[model samples]
Structure formats: structure tokens, C-alpha cells
Target: RPGKEPEVDLPYYHPRAPSAEVEMTAYVLLAALKTEPAPSQEELSFSSLIAKWISSQQNPNGGFSSTQDTVVALQALSQYGAVTYAKSGAASKVTLRSGGEFQQDFQVDATNRLLLQRVPLPQVPGEYSTEVSGEGCVYLQTSLRYNVQPMQEDAPFTLHVSTIPETCADSKAHKVFDIGINVSYTGERNGSNMVIVDVKMLSGFIPLKSSVRKLERHPIIERTELSTNHVLVYLEK
Candidate 1:
């Protein structure tokens, strides 16, 4: 429905209803358009409305009503800044030295140019100084990419988790105790949806066998693996 039209008008059933989700999605779309190498005419048309809606959702403290919406909106805005305002290509030189013990010089030019670099240095403890000079910009910040790692899975709805005991007992003599936990999902979804809750425990704690039970609702499957420190609870929406 988004791509079918250049602009979208959010429809609200009630005047007092919150529009965080719709506004956040539109902010993400606007961010994508701002970061495009070359935006089309359709994307350009939605620019004004997207900015207006996103700004309207911002609170006085510079945050959204919901944590998830804030995260998505900030991510979109940051991506736009990184792509749109990238430094221009020009000649540059960077020199680094650590207490005069180690020194390295880097030059960026047409013949000797690099998109990535790795400079191995010996372990030394001292104050370091870097001097960047030339016509262009020098970026020292590094981007960490985890390609093989799995993307974090978000809960389909909002979750509120609470435990009975605020502080854990400090003991080492084979302690056995009872803990009560309450989990509430606040997102609206159909009854046929599936919710998978994964719990991982820290070292030295093991879940008791046949201890997991739903006091209020029924679950499809409940399992625990002590070896890997994992507990999985699956429930229907």
C-alpha cells in the first residue's frame, strides 16, 4: 500500500488514539529515502509529510511514547545522517604516534587508496596523539559488522516481566529456592499467533525439572535444557 501512492494519510478511529506505530513506520520510510543514492520523484514527494509526522511524535524530552517506536525512529534518522552527509573524496594524510615509540603514516590519494585498513601495533601504554592534515576528511571511527551472527528477534508485542525477589540470595551451599515470575504481553494480535519465549540463565543456575508451568494460560510446549542453560516456552496468541 505504501509504494502504490506517493503520500499516505493516517486514519484514526478516535481522536484521542495514539499513532506511534504509523508515525514510526513513516519515519523509517523517510529515512530510507534520505539515504538513497538517488531518490525518485515519488520518494521526494513524501518528504514534507514524513518530516512533519515524525517531528509531531517527538516528546519534549526528544523521545517517543513507546521504546520500540523510539528505537526504530532513531535508527532511521541516524542512517540518514550517516549516508547523506558522508565526507567528500579528496587528498588526505593521517599521522599517529604513541609517546614517540610507535609511529604510522597513512596517505589517501588516487593511486594509493583504500576503503578499509588494518594497522597492527604492539601493546603499549602511553598517551597517543593523531594529526590529520590534507584537503579531505579522515575518518578514524570503525564500523563493526556481525554478518554471521543472527539478528536479534523482537517480541511480536510488548512484554512486561517482573520477578518476586528483587535481589538474589548470596549463598553457595546448594541453595534451593522458589521464584515467581510474571510476564504480560501488551501487543494486539490474533488468537492464532504463536509466541515463543526464550530464557537463558547465567552460569551456576539450573532450572528445576518440571518446574515451569503456566498458572493462568495454557502453553503449547515448554522445555528446558540445563546443559545449554536455556528454557523455551511456546504459547498461542
Candidate 2:
């Protein structure tokens, strides 16, 4: 069967740190903005919320914890600033104040809208606030567009099967057999990809997994529905 390309949503939270999740969410939002045609107001609101969440997770050092997290978070913030939180053409100022002791301001304009502005927050145990009154706010709308490909017609493939022990050793009624399956793909382009095989057993015969091996790639036993008397195996190359 042919594969499909589908767009998946970014989760609001993940098992990792909040910063990593925020970065992933930002990447998804930016990707949607680029690929989608139009977005709804609700989506804009949700994306804004996610951006604010990402901002909140910033550490006093102005970066995330691990190297990977920091790199992704910074990239996400840069994308958000470029595609979502861009400033207007008119001159605007954003202020940051902490514990009534620290204060700073940044000037923004449409020419530098794509630039990411970072304000390091102090590690002091106190309150901090940011105020922005400008011609534009930090919000944008985007849609996620993607398509799924239809299954293609199956092409002819080669399969070789052999039974071990040549014949059943014990009584015919209770004897078991070991089946060896060899799948060969001589197709072009990467030589091979992935193939799925289905094996159905009759009313009296049973399948056992005493030994299983593959040559070119690993085999995955995806489905083993004993109730349905069907077994599905996946081979990757």
C-alpha cells in the first residue's frame, strides 16, 4: 500500500519540560501559517496563548535548560516573531520592569519585525511585568493544510516459503511445524522500502513464533489477531 502524508496537531503539553513543548507548539504553528490558506479567530487566540506560554517558560538566563531545548525554543521564538508578532511600521516601544528596580525599553518597527527581541529576566525572587502599547499586538492566525495519498495498486513481489524439519515428527494430529518465510524485493530506487504480509490459518492449523529472522531489514509483527485467525508482518528495507 502507498503511504500518506498527514499533518498532525501539536500537543499543548508533553512529557518533557514545558519549554520543549512550547518550542514544538511554536514550530507547528509556524508551519501551519506557512502551508495553510486561512485560519480562524479561535486558532489565532489559541496560538497567541501558546506564544505567551512559551514566553512564560523563559528562564532567568534567557534560554531553556538543555542545549537541544534551548536551540529549539530560540528557533521557535524567532519564527513566532517573524510570522506572528511582527511590529507595525510606526515606531513602538516595549517595556520590561522587575521588582521596581530594573527597567528597560526596546524600540521596534516594521523594518525589524522579523528580528527576535530578547529581554533577560533577573533571577531575583520578585515580581516582573512587561507592557507593550503599540500599533500592533502579538497575535496572528494560521491554518494547517495537508493531504493524504491514496493507496496504490500492489505490484508483483517475490516470496519464498519453506517448512523446517521437512515433515511433522510426532503424531499428525498434534505435530507442529516451523515455517520460514523469505521475501525478496528487486525493485529499483533504494532497492526496497516496506512490505506487509498477511498469513491466514485454517481451522485446524496453528502458527508459532519459535524462530523468526530477516536478511535485508528487520521484521515487525504488527498484528496477531488470534480471534480472527490472521497474522500481519511488516518488513522494512
Candidate 3:
């Protein structure tokens, strides 16, 4: 219905309010889209919209809602970009303006499509607007980060981390140490979503796999993984 002359949306309603089955269908659809060859205009148009929606779901870190979704969505969208490579040799002018005083322009075309173009804003607290008037796709990302200290009780999630055998306590016992982690979900929902904890090992030190296995057996831990320099822990909430 998406590419129709008078388009109508697909009904997403189910007999019951919510179901995991419906959510699983999303992955299946993404997998099918990844393998699909959109030869026809209709399929291409629909897939383009799906790709846009997936891009919109990207987090500030340039990933989708979750690690798994990010991997699958990117695989599908990467293929989409390859098929839609510009052939008309079109260009887009991206104009950034703030309060009619600060302005900058960038040109995007096939030759420089994959290049990163950065424009620094002079003003810290300024209202800005952007205008794009040409054909091909242009992805723009702005980075501004700050730290906030939330009140202890008001924080959505709380973490307490410590290590056994304090540095002052031992010389020979320093060969191995135990790390303790305590986390709590304090949000309004029943619980938080799946959480990924990434621990980077100090130089010349690697986490013991046996210790990681002990975490995997914990009732609350969903999974644990070991990589070259990082230990990843997944928690299901």
C-alpha cells in the first residue's frame, strides 16, 4: 500500500494487545528484505521507506535500538545503498544557519558521498536550521555531549562496582583479583531492557574465562562473552 497512487497503511493490529510473535516477525521481515532484490519500482519504493525508518531508529552512537537489531538492520540497509547508487550525477547543497548570522554550506555528490564533512558551530547556545535542496541522500550527524549528575534515588539505573583484595592488603595474592558488580533497575517500567556491560581489561591483563563462566551461571545474567580486550556481559530484564 505504501507506493500506491492513494496510499494506505498496513494494519499492524493484532487480536491481543501485544505479543512476542509479532515482534519476532520484524526480524523475519528484515532478513527477507536483506535478501530481497527490489527489481520493481513498487518494491524499491517500499524498501526505501523501510530503510529510512531503520535509519531513524539509530541511536546517537549510530546504532539501532539494540545490538542484534543494529547488526541486522545495517546489513540490510548497506545492500539498499548499493542498489540505489546515484546514476544521474545529482548534488545536494546542505546549508546550516543560525539566527541569520552564522552560516555554512556543504556540497554532497556521488564523489564525496562517503566522506565525512564536519562543520564546527561557533555559538554554544544557538538556534539553528538546515536546508537541503538537492537529490541524493545526505546523512548529517551532530555531536554535543555533556555530563549530568542525577540524584541518587532519581537515577533510573544504579551500579555499584568493587574489587576484592584491596591494593594495600596483598603483594603475592595480587596475581588474581575478583570484581564485584551490583546493578539495580529503578525505572517506571517493570524492568529495563537488555543491558550490555563492557569491561576493558587493563594493559597486560586479561579476564580469566573461568571467572566469566561463573558470571554466566548467575540467575540474573543472560550471557557473558570474552573478546580480545573486553569482557561483555548481557542482562535480560
TM-score per prediction, in order, is 0.30, 0.35, 0.49
Candidate 3: C-alpha lDDT? 0.71
Kindly report which residue pairs in candidate 1 clash with one another: none
Off by over 4 Å in 1: 1-156, 169-174, 190-192, 213-227
lDDT of each: 0.55, 0.58, 0.71
- For residues 72-157, could you state the per-residue lDDT of candidate 2 as single tens digits? 76776666565654334666678778876799787767776546666555644457676777776532211222356766965557
**In model 1, where is the ten-residue run with the lowest total lDDT?**
8-17
Per-residue lDDT of model 3, residues 51-109, tens digit only = 66566555557765466666766676776787767687899999999995889999998
User: Per-prediction count of colliding residue pairs?
Assistant: 0, 0, 0
Query: Could you list the CA RMSD of all candidates, in the order they appear?
Result: 17.2, 19.0, 13.1
Clashing pairs in 2: none
Error of 1 at 64 (Å): 36
Please give the RMSD of candidate 2 to the true structure: 19.0
Superposed Cα RMSD, model 1:
17.2
TM accuracy, model 1:
0.30
